[model samples]
Target: MNQWLLYGVLALLPLAALSGFLMGRKHRKGKQDNRLSSDYIKGLNYLLNEQPDKAVDTFIDLLKVDTDTVETHLALGNLFRKRGEVDRSIRLHQNLIARPQLSSRDRNSALFQLGLDYNAVGMYDRSEKLFKELLSDPVHKNESLVQLLNIHQLTRDWDDATKIAEELQSSLGVEQSKPIAHFYCELAAQKRQDGDIKAALSNVKKALTINPDSVRASLLQGDIHLQQKSYKQAIKSYQRILQQDIAFLPEALPNIAEAYSNIKDNSGYRSFLNKSLDAGAGVSVLVELSKIIQAEKDDRAAAELIGNFLKERPSLKGLQRLITLHIEHAQDSAKPSLQLLDDIVEKLISKKPRYACHNCGFETKAIYWQCPSCKEWSSVKPIKGIEGE
Candidate 1:
């Protein structure tokens, strides 16, 4: 819908309901019913003719403040807020709140809608007060708690968010474990940045307790272990990711290899990569495995492995790695042409994005546990295609 049209519809809603109410009250008296119906028809005619401004003016003049129209006014204000016309919605809702005749329930509802209007326009302080007020009202406790959770998330107040999430889970029966784990992960990240590794590890473990399959928690644990130079523990953490979610295999490979290298276990690293490849992992795993093969065995074996994998899962990264292997072993006659091909493949692979979000189709050159565009956890994974792996 056109934005203006949506606003116009919201503006006319209360007037339409008021007209109906007036018509119903006058039905027993049988007085001037035709006039009320005529006014409504004219307003609708203006809307149909695309004269939304005139329709809004007509509706505003026709609507009157009364109990019968309070719900209609609240509904209209909420519609405006949903359409992003926060100023108009706030005006309508605030007007409703000021009316002395409004019932306690209706008043609270208007306040809640006005709070949402403030939130929509980024007025967090004002929205926070209104939500806090609503939180005290038994009728709006659950909804208020949820909105407070959103506000806490926006402000990055993980502690407050965790508290409200727990309340929402218990009071409203809404599962919040996943989001709660994300909150702990955020706390862990903050602690890690502050050099409080012990506190960071504790928070990460709490995240895992909330969500055992949380890739973010595992990643953080591995990073902490790597920082402490606990190579075996880091290797264990990175390897756990594969069993938790195979889509994260690409993220674990480089870190896993580093941990193994630190422990001087080239043979163990090579075995791990081979196992990942045999499990039909993506081209990223295959490429890493091929590199290990080239380092340990020979260029020919690496090239052959890449060629066979490319037949099963064609990818630019795999092809680029294969070209590099061929270029290394090419004779004087074939060296220049192979080098040129290798350069072309390298350019192609470098230009392609390494990861993409399945939920939002957001592409990125680097891996992210949370999608940068959609802010969804574990959504961005290795991009697999002709120009990616």
Candidate 2:
């Protein structure tokens, strides 16, 4: 019922007719011509009867997959798949593959298309098996490996993904370090969830070795150390994010503060917060630095810091914190009004997404190392603007 499918069927009608004509010419036999003509007429009747599926089936059956007609069959099947007719595409490719006269190359092509058909419908196990069978294929080897990587990513089989990525890079000269690092980070996260800190650290180390600029790896490494109460080591790991990618400094600020707190080093925490603020960290850094100032000095001093910041870079988060500071120091009559303003800002910030995909514009409240919409590695980062870091 899709308009694209309708268009595709209409386009294929002529190709089917052309294929039949060409095959008839190639054969130059009266009986073969009569068979092709009869089948073509039958297909036209199905179309006239308003059964497009039947028409399509009949025409594709008439244009059998052979040297002369294989490309037409492939084009039709791929078009069906692109038009969201996966079932029809699968059937066409299956029929093409079943033909005994198809060349090895064409058969591989059909198999790959069939695998894609299965993948489109979320039948990943079947697609995985088909793609794996094509690993040694000359034409489809790299592509199959790429598909296999996708399947493993969907299945959360990080180990298999790592192997396939390594093979893709080593054999094909593909640059896969970024994804390879993320794969190790995934494995580390799984291990960390299972409470295997040693294995988690090992995987994080591998991730860092693969990509020293991996902010996710550094965050994971810092978390593992913090969990073990190795506060100094955790601080070291968390600070590494600044050198790796300063855009992620906001993510590390709170944890770094917690680490310094565990070691009872407020001065060092304040110094680190100031350094991060100087390095263009987000509003979170400013908020933490204000908290430190409020503890050491006074509410008015902290308010001044945030008020100065808001002048330079306006942020809802900064404004929210500034309102909180004003509420603390305001007269009782003004407190309710400031509190109401604070609640509005808080609610607005809560409704806004904290992270978004760089590859696609998919936004979410939580961070995803791989984008949920685009399924790209490390594409999701903290959103930047008034409502976010």
Candidate 3:
């Protein structure tokens, strides 16, 4: 709800009560002498003028904190949280929690809200305990479990996260395969980094079993295979990523090429890139193919390949690479001009973003499986266009 509208409603509550109180006095005593606080009067005027921003704070300050004003207090605390004033929200909810007279429902509501406040401020341990406490109440259980999952994820407590995800799936009937798969993948990455290859591959297999389309799981499996010099398995794993999501095909290119070359199968790599290009992967595929052509054929052949691809896609990176190749092999008389153009294109390509979030339009120089700003999973992908691939 709009803050102003919420404030406007809060402003009306006291006014409505006061107005009824005055009318009762008039009916009983027949006088126009009923009094209200000056702040209350000013706040009512502000609300009448649609300036509830000024009215809400002024009115809530003058109102006594009691059962009568609990709703207003909660609304104000929510507003504070929305505005990122987490400390203020925490204090308000804590005060509400301390009120012995509060009903059971209201107390639980305040406790749940305070848990969120703690979560917002990076007190994951506190929030985790608080959410665990709320898990017995059906009203707060699902949301608290979700919050606990987020906290576990933030803390990299994969064991705890896996347990909660499975429980949520069974008890709450919530589908958790994606998150469960990611949790296993996270475990795989950690184990792989620790050189526990057996455990890492085991986790990778579990992730893939849970979510067959998990690109991260496939990528991890491919990386593990490549590290083990299992070229055929690595190539198969990398190829699976293209089937899972072609948007991430670029991420697999370098590893796939290396695996092919490790096995003396450059032609296979070349064939894969061409097939991917025919299916519309992007400029990275073209660039890699051109590099392969240059290695196998000549500078002129590579340049012509890039030239044709750029003619269709018109990428600054592709153009820059083409110019770099020319400058590398250009005649001495023409080197300086080509060098200037290459430098210009290089700067332009450097300034361009290489990845963007499909959900939020957040741009970045590098790919991210989870968007930093939006916290969305698998939303940031390698950008596709002339300037990106």
Candidate 4:
């Protein structure tokens, strides 16, 4: 297979680096040429025998770690790590780190590589300790902080993630507020699940203060207020999402309607849905608004609304809904055919994913604020197409 060929070539990278290293030293160290030549021949024989591990070992044994050869070792180790050969990468880096003659810069670089090797294999404690040691190294400080933040996130230590994010923002001028706000939202969600409404609200407020335009924060705040029977305040929080990002209006619509229902404000809910539709809300909003119309007037009025929208922008969901309304009032002979058509449209809509990640194109029927594939925050939105929204 092609993959086996690539692995074979990757296994020979250290041999190539060592050959280059020795040749660069040959002119100045003429007395050592005979031993170097013999060892090179032995390595080549090993490679020709398809014993790449023996070839690599022979090459490593010949190359001494020094100021001139440290970079070569680091590069080879990084290459191995990138190829998913973590054990080989870790061994190479450890070999380099074990040499006391290495300079401070070379040692720190090796440590960073080893930390990455550990991090790749989910050895977080080892990776965290190594990264912590490099926090004082000016060349690696910012990157080490970033890796530490990543570890904290994986471990679900939101408090630690927040601290690291703040440090990245203030010390390095890296834009971390978006992730930091998400961290607060994470903490708020935890507290809300634990039934500590007061603490949950406090964390949500902190998130909003950090990033006022966070749609997730607004949604979380609205949910928390709804749980506390603060229906009017919940409406305010849900309404803020429309102003922040109209694209996410669908996510808040069902909850907004629920909040209005709790307060006995059907008219207010209908008015809000109309405004959202005017602001270019998608098929979900249209569908919600159609429900209200059908309840208030008739199936014909609801079908008419979806028909008008589909005239300008086609949707499988809209067509399915429209077909269902017609089937409700059809003649007995026509009902079977209408029901069959509705069933076909319903299946088509059901098979399509409801959401997709903008960053990674990961599609799913359920919602995720952080994309599962790319690990990006707030990237997954409701999919917009004929079969979506």
Best by TM-score: 2
Q: How accurate locally is residue 333 in candidate 1, as Cα lDDT from 0 to 100?
A: 98
Model 3 bad stretches (over 4 Å): 1-67, 80-88, 166-176, 328-331
State the lDDT of candidate 1 residue by residue for 1-389, as single tens digits.
68877776666666666666776777767765566678778888887777876675566545555766777777777766787777878888888888898888889999999998999999998998999898889998888998898899889999898999999999989888888998999999999999999999999999999989888789889989998999999888877777677667777777888899999998898888777766656888888877777777888988898898789788877887887777766798999998888788888878888888999999989877667788666677776678765
Over the stretch 129-165, how does candidate 4's per-residue lDDT look in tens digits? 9999999999999999999999999999999999999
Cα lDDT, model 1, residue 162: 94
| Residues 1-389 of candidate 3: C-alpha lDDT, one tens digit per residue | 58868765674666446544544555576654335445557767777777765665565555445666677678768877888879878987888888788888788888899898998899988989999999999999889889888899889999899999898898889788887988999999999999999999999999999999999999999999999999999999989877788878888888998999899987889999998888877777888988889989998999998898887888888888798778878899999999888888888888989889988999999877678889777778887776676
> Which stretches of model 1 miss by more than 4 angstroms?
1-62, 136-139, 331-337, 372-375, 385-388
* Two-way lDDT contest, 1 vs 3, winner: 3
Higher-ranked by TM-score: 3 or 4: 4
Q: What is the alpha-carbon lDDT for the whole of candidate 3? A: 0.83
Clashing pairs in 2: none
Question: Residue 182 lDDT in model 4?
Answer: 94
Model 2: lowest-lDDT 10 consecutive positions: 23-32
Record all residue pairs in model 3 with backbone atoms less than 3 Å apart, i.e. clashing: 315-386
Q: Cα deviation of 168 in candidate 2 (Å)? A: 1.9
lDDT of 2 by residue, 151-227 (tens): 99889999999999999999799889999999999999999999888999999999999999999999999989998
lDDT for 1 (candidate 3) = 50
